[model samples]
Structures are given as structure tokens and as C-alpha cells.
Target: MFSAAAALLAGAAAQPAGAEEETGSGHAVVRPVSGVSPLPADCGEPPIDGYVLNPNAEVLPTVATDPNRPWHLVTVYQQDRWNRYGSNGAVTAVSDDYGKTWRQSDNLPPFSRCNGGTAANGGDYEVTTDNWVTITPSGAAIAASLSLSRTGETTAILVSRSGDGGRTWDAPATLARDDNAQFFNDRPVVTADPYHPGVVYAVWDRVDATDAGWTQPVYLAKSTDDGRTWTTSKVYDFPDNSGVIGTQLVPLADGTLLIGMHHETDTTAATQVIRSTDGGATWSQPTLNVPAPFAVGVRIPDPDNSGDPIRNASLPLLAARPGTGVVSAVWQSQAADGTFHIDYAQSKDAGLTWSSPVRIDKTPVGSAAVPVVAASPNGTVAVTYYDFRNNTADPATLPTDVWAVTCKSNCTQPASWREQHIEGPFDARKVPLTSAGRLVGDYSGLVSVGRSAFTAVYGVATGDSANPVDIHSAIFTG
Candidate 1:
């Protein structure tokens, strides 16, 4: 049943005009971009700025295999200087073989280097870059939303595409054309519904960052014509947007749109949901707010509400119904052991309601990174995250790896989580993915942690290893 469901979900998860074929090994094979075929880039030993070329770094592995080219697998990410930093600018790369060979799309769609130095209105924005990547259903189309900012400006959003698998692109068109001074950025999740893959949804937090204070609201837009044309702005009801953390979107089985939002608030805060039965035009008012542990009385807040060194620290995930409409949410609870305890909540009824939170990560690992929710048709649950509950790994720190645990069906989580070391040849571990072994880290860059069939994705730190990040991506399936 699970295998059968997976087949159907494969169809449902199709991006609108998605990626096409090519070949390589390990999940992907690297090669020269079509136009630059004979000219292999010198990624170098330490890699150069805007060209460090981790060729190993991978982000948001939107994986697909070309039907005609049974030997090739395709993956995509924002190329940049090695270190994972900077959302202000981004580039795209692809791998043909499973996860072995790779290539960066140098021939971009006539884009102006607006942010890096082209800050016409450019200014310093988040060091993070792109997180979400989507390809058309037929794998013929590709779209990526990048974070941007102008001189003395807040962060902005940009979208670019290519007809030939990340090859040459149309000069990236400014998706956030109305950037009057809003710092709307982070977590750009883009995907096309399977039924009508042509219809694309670009959802992100639209923030108003004026000196007075920052008011961030989650906004979503739909492109019926594959982004060539987009629907007018509509603010999806996610009051949690006050500082709405990552809002994960999943196209449900019954044509209903399900959204799982994680929150920063404590008592009154709980992951909430809103749905679009009629596409995205209308969304239900905020669902019953499911307060965090503090409010439930099961968990107590820090007496002082002390600030965690990591603000925007919490990461939540939604188990999207790849081909069906089953939605489940998972996250590390505030009452967590810091080492790596993860909890899960499900909304079988399509976001209308949720089950009580359950501790899904039972392994009691030393520490936990972020959690990812990848749903199979029969609801086979694949939850992956990092184990740092006890201590984190660093090239200078220690050996850290990406970990994952699986369940037989939806909601049937394991009693204890198991660890899988996913430190690519590079060994940078972060942003654990639910889809496979994917991780999101540094440049907002994403890649696979270690070398395993299960693909891991994360960013590489370049400058200062803390600032001006770029994005990278790759895939492996163990």
C-alpha cells in the first residue's frame, strides 16, 4: 500500500513545468552547463568568492529523473561564494547523474546584478539566500524565489526561471516589484499543484520593516500562467505572522490547500492552519490556536523568558501530501531537552483541526537540528533532523551528521529516532529535510550532509563564515 501510495504521490508532487533529464551518479552527475560545456569551471580547492564552487553544496533538492534519459537525475540550488550567506543575490545550479556530477547554470536569463553590487536600492539584508525551489509539473519549467534588497533598503524578493533545466535563464524578474521599503523575505516556498501544475504559488512572509518596529505578515500570490502572470496580492490569514516563522505549504489530495505555520509566541502561540478549497483566493479564518507547551500546563516557560542565543530559533515542518491531501506538522517543542527531542501534530482533516502534539523523535539524541516532514501517499512518515541535543559538530567544533527516522504509516512514529550521518564530502550539517536527506543551512544554501543514497542539502559558509552567504544543493538516496 505504501509503495502504491508513493507512486500516486509522485504524480501529486509534480511541479508545474518541472525539471527534465540528464545523467550522472549518486543521485546526480556533474557536467558543464550546455552553453559552457567545453569550459569546466575552476571551483578550486578553497573555492573563490562568488565562485568558491563547493560543487558539493546543495539546497532544496527538487529531485526528478528524465523519462527519456533514464540515466540522469536533476537537482537545483542558488550558486554563490562558498560560505552560506546573502539572500540579496543568488544563482542556479543542477546535477544530472544521481548526486555525483554537477553543473551551475551560468547563462542566466538576462538579469542585472542588482543586489551584490547593483544595490540600486540595495543595502545589507539577511545573509540568507533562497530556501524553496519549484519546477513545473511536466519538469519543463523551473522557478526560484531569491531574497533581495537595494541601497539602504530592507530585503526584497526575486524570481527567475529556465526552460532547459537550470541552463540559461530569463533575466530574473523582480517578483516584489512593489518594494517601497518592506523587508519581506525568508522561506520562499514555491510549488505547482499536480492537477494543474501550471498554476504556481509563491508564498513568503511580507514584512513591513519601518524604523518604528517590524510588522511581518504572510502574503501569498498565485500564477495561473506559470508566473508569466500572477494574481493580485492576498494576505493569507496567519496572525502568527506577527513574526510568523516558516509557513509550510502543501497541496492536499482533495484539491484543498493546506498550510502549516510555526509560531514564535509562547502561551497564545501554537502552529495554526488555513486552507483554500477553491484554490488560493479564499482562506478560512485562523483555526483554533493550539498554544505551545507553556499554555497547555504540561510545560513551563523559562522564569525570566530569557532570550535563547538563537532567535528565530524554532523550525517546524509540514508533512505534505505529495500526491494526496494528508497534512501533519512536526517541530522541536519549547519544553524540549535541547539535545534533540522532536514532537509532531497532525491535521488529518486537512488543517481544519489537529491532534495533540506527540514526541516523535524518541531516540533522545544528544542534540537536534531542525525537523523535516515528507509525507508518502499511504502516509509513510519520513522525519529527518540534526542530532546536536548534546553538542553540535563543527569543522573546528566536532563531527555532526544529519539523522532521520521513519514510520510505517502516517502518525505511526517510531519509539526512538535513529541517526544517519549525512556530512557530504564537505561535512556541513544543517536544515534536515523530510523529503530525503536534504538539509538547509548557511547561504540559505541547501545540500546533503554526507555521502549516502539519501540526499542531504545545506549551505556553505564563505566570507567570515558568518556573513554574506550563498546557496548550494545536491542529492543522495541511501
Candidate 2:
């Protein structure tokens, strides 16, 4: 089933084009894009309710475009998501026409049974999560995910390479793995070096238990020869009772690697960054970027589902401006009224010194969640997030909308940013309900297409039980 569906969706065949509309913010156009890779009915093992669960759902998309070829875009997302956990596997979709169309890839290294995983191939995990993709300077595309067993016995970080655009992928290379439940790995993010052609990096958190308490060490894997093989090491480890997650690598043009992470202790939480000047050999102590007021890590109470909470997070997203040392970060922060707002901050000296955080979400009445940031070559910084401003009072339905804000100059100024509607007013309540809550995704994808444009890939609800959520793409131009 997986092979057949992959073959069907693997080419230049176009998915339905969404309506085109112009935004009031003077943006050129807002074009919605959809993928053709819907999960098959039988996507292999770990069946749910006597059949594959959420067969038509796709979520947690990550998009990257080639620098040499801007029109060549690739997005990796989870397909056939389960209610409580991960999807059947991670899949890739390639768009050569600047996201006007896409080709879905079926060869993702078989991280789960749905994609042909087996115990002998080191991909026998029951599910796969945290799908991330990056394009190296040499035009090689790399996809990474956290594959784990159903019984929590094994967790591994695996990456696959696409020498072509993203049309096909090679078998995965395991960067790091843990067979014991005591040491679990989570939230793996892969990054390709913008300055080096064949150098790639993968970072994640390894949660370990000890006599003192729980500790999470940030692990780094370097593949100098593209994504063929990797050397893993512990770059930074939090103290006892403290751990870090959502680690993202921001490689600068000057050979410095900056890792942005969400650090949490028993009583405190903050967003921090660790720098590696001489590659991944050693990392400096973390420098605090922003302090999280609330410990709200990912899951929030769903107004519609009392038993389930929305899988949202305030995870910091850091992006470096192309050909510049300036880096910007964005994350959602909870307010006194229990509503979440998008916050923005910038670092001029490569994550060493950060400006004060500023609220960026324009909608005053509702909460915002899952913010993603990107910086263009022309020094324009943009962010995309979902908000509940359009939601009604009805408990049975939660109307949500996607929005994007672009800053041309000083992003630190609240008035310098202009907000534009990307897509939405779709009922989030109609999406698949998971144990974590209504499923959208932990994060979305926003990548700069050129000097004044960006392509955002996000998840939306379809209101159909057979296909509740879909991965969507939108092109925004200034």
C-alpha cells in the first residue's frame, strides 16, 4: 500500500491548487498549496481500532529551499498520524515550481512499519516523530526524525539523504540510538552547513536518569561527508533535575555553530543558546536568551475537549539572516490572562547578546500558538503562527486562522511589523483528536524563497473523519 501510493504521488502530478487571494497588507499574493501524498489505508504495523488510524492525516511539516535553485523546494512531514503518538512515518514532498506544485517521496528509509521498517534494518520502530529536512550548500537534501518502539524500549535519530532535489531518498543513517528506556532521545533537528558543502549536523536531547535526578544532554552528530555517515557526541548537558529539548542549530557563515534549545529545570524554564566556535568539538555554556514565564511546555488544555489538550509549544525558533551575523528568534509566551502571544527577539552577535523580547502577535483578543520564523536575504524577518481570534464561543467548534508578519527594518519595534492573513478560519476542532489533544502539530515550516518572499507549510483541519488534517503550503510576498 505504501509503495503503491508513493509511486502514484511521486512525480510532477499536481495536487489541487487553492484559491488565490491578495492580502490587505500589500503583499503580492496568498496562494495555498496542498500535497498529493495521503496515507494508504494499510500503512503497515501498529494498527489502531482494527485499521490504520488517521490514514489521511499529515502534520509537522518542515520546508527547505535550495539556495542555488530557489524554485526547488522540499518539505518533509509526518503521514498517517496516530491519535496519541507519532505518524506511520515521515514523508517528503518536492516542489520545483516554487511551491505551486509538489511531488511526494515514498522512499524515507523505512523508519516505521508503514514504510517497510524491519528489525534487521535498524528501523523497526513502531512510530516516527519530529520530521525535519535541510538542504546543504551542495544541493543535497537531508531528512531527520526520531524513531522509537511502541514499548519505549528503543529511540533513535535517523537521517536520510536526497542527492537529487527531494524526489527520492537513500536509506537512513542512524546518528544516535538508545535501546534502553532509561535513556530516551527526543526532538531531533537536522541542519546542513551553509558555509560547508558536505558538512551536516544533527542535534537532539537525550533524557537520562541518575541517582540525583533526571538530566538531559544535548547530543550533536556531524556528517562531514554529507548524510552518508555520522559521528555522535555530547555537546552540552544540563545539570541534575534539568533538561533541554527542542534544540535547533543555527550555523553562521563564519564557521560558528549556534544551538538554540529550550532548557527546563524542576522550577524554572528558559530559552538558551550554546555556541561551538571550532565545529562540534566543544560547546560553550548556554547563554539565556529569554525566560519562559510559564512552564507551559507544548500541551495546553483544549477548550473543546476536556479530556485532551492541544499539542502546542513555546519552543524558540532561531534563524540567521542570509549573509549576515544577525539572528532572530520567535516563540509563543503565555500571558497573565492565560492567553498565549507570539514574542520576538534578535541577536546581533551570533546569539551572544539578545535584544529584549517583544510581543509580535497583532490580534489582541485571542491566543497564538506554534510560531515559526525565517529571515530573507534582504534582511526581512517573517513569522507565521496560528491564532484563535476567529474562533467562536461554541464549544463544539474551534475556528482557527494562520497569519504571517514581516519586518523590513528594525524588527524590535512593534510598529515596524506588518501582519498578513495566510490561511485559515478552518475549524480546528474538526481535526483528529489525540491523547495530547486536537492535533495540528508541534511546529510548522517557514522558509525564505527570495529577497521579499516566503513559503510556509502548515497543517489544517479538513473536517472529515477519514481525512481530518492536511499539510498545506502558502506563498507570501511583500
Could you estimate the TM-score for every candidate?
A: 0.67, 0.90
Count backbone clashes in candidate 1.
111
Per-residue lDDT of candidate 2, residues 1-478 (tens digit):
3343234234334432321222224343433344334544565465646233567678888999887766667898888777655777777777765665566663665677766677777677788888899998777889898988754578889888888667677777888888888899989899888888889999999989766689998899999898878999988876689888899998997787888888888888887878888897888887645778667445654555445456665477899998777999887787886778888888888777788889988976757888999998889898998877776667778888889999999899999999988887888877666765677667999888777778888988877776677777877864
Identify the candidate with maximal lDDT: 2
| Model 1 worst lDDT window (10 residues) | 295-304
> lDDT (CA) for every model shown?
0.45, 0.77
Q: Looking at candidate 2, what is the lDDT of residue 338?
A: 70
The candidate maximizing TM-score is 2
Tens digit of lDDT per residue, candidate 1, span 174-257? Answer: 556444655555556666665675777777766555655555566776777765566546465333324564665667768888
